[model samples]
Target: MRVLLVEDNGDFALPCRQLLAALRGVQVVQTAASAQEACDWLRANPGGWDLVVVDLFLGQGHGFTVLRECAGRPPLQRAVVLSAYADETARQYARKAGADAFFSKTNEMDALLAYCLQLAGEVDGANR
Candidate 1:
């Protein structure tokens, strides 16, 4: 499974890559630091990506715009919000904006890993 991780902070981005590296058949194809960058990638690649892990706050633009860019993605493609701002309001807005799931960075790292693992399993199974 290919992933596009949209995170501007180096600290969080490194850890995220580390965690995702442990999963078999999962590769982070690219990392975008801003909403425009992510949107550009999406437009350039269309179905090139299988998953997008987005952080709400970016250095140059908001993750919400990135999420909006992911609207009407393919069935196998998913967009998830992995952010520090995982409050109820954020969750609701993320869902409305087009995130397939929302996971808090501070406390939900395990959940994020599990979600990725599940997708990897499905992808692996289908490939088999």
Candidate 2:
């Protein structure tokens, strides 16, 4: 499954990338720093990405715009919000905006990937 990781934090990006790299069947893993870049990439790579993992707080304005831009696309239906801000509002907004899952950056990324794998049927989900 091709995945796009939209995270601005370098520290978090590396380990996440490493973990995804270890997982099998994840063909294209691209990382973008901002909402604009992500939106542009998505438009250019439609039907190319299976999932988009985005951060709610992009250190800029609302990152919801990125999700909004991709929500209408068929292949972009699978999305997850990975953010450091673990607020109810953010979670609610992400869910309402069509995020398949909401994950705090501090949580186990394996769980996030497992969730994605489950939603996409590309890899083993964490279902015991």
Candidate 3:
């Protein structure tokens, strides 16, 4: 499986890479610090990526805007939102924008991993 992470913080991006690498199926992991960078990368890869993990507050452009773009593209629809700002309103926005899952950095890491695995179609989140 291939995954793309759009995160600006080095601390968060590093751990996300390690976690994706640790997963059994995930082999290729890519990172982009900004939404525009991610958009460009995805354009090059075009339906080649398995999943996309995006931060809600990207320090500049909003993740929702990127997701909106993804929704317009074909099956570029496998997306998840990961951020410290996991409020109900934010979650609703993500869901409306076509996110498969929404997670908080403060939540249990295991649960987050399980959710990601499920989103990647490797495992079932409901089984956890």
Question: Local distance difference test, per candidate?
Answer: 0.91, 0.76, 0.77
Question: Could you estimate the TM-score for every candidate?
Answer: 0.95, 0.84, 0.85
lDDT per residue as tens, model 1, 1-128? 89999999998798898788778888999999889999999999997888899999998999999999988887778999999999999999999999999999999999998999899888778769
Shift in Å, residue 32, candidate 2: 0.5
Q: Could you tell me the TM-score of candidate 2?
A: 0.84
Against the true structure, candidate 2 has what lDDT?
A: 0.76
Ranking by TM-score: 1, 3, 2
Deviating ranges (above 4 Å) for candidate 2? 120-128
Candidate 3 vs. true structure, TM-score: 0.85
lDDT by residue (18-114, candidate 3, tens digit) is 9877887665457888888887888888766777888888876878866775775545347888889988999999999988788888885677688
The top-ranked prediction according to lDDT is 1
Candidate 1 residue runs with Cα over 4 Å from true position: none
Order the candidate numbers by lDDT, best to worst: 1, 3, 2
Q: Which residue pairs in model 1 clash with each other?
A: none
- Model 3, residue 72: displacement in angstroms? 4.5
> Which digits, one per residue and each the tens of the lDDT, describe model 2 over residues 86-113?
6898899898887878888776566887
Itemize residue pairs with steric clashes in candidate 2.
none
In model 1, state the lDDT of residue 87.
Answer: 97
Error of 1 at 112 (Å): 0.3
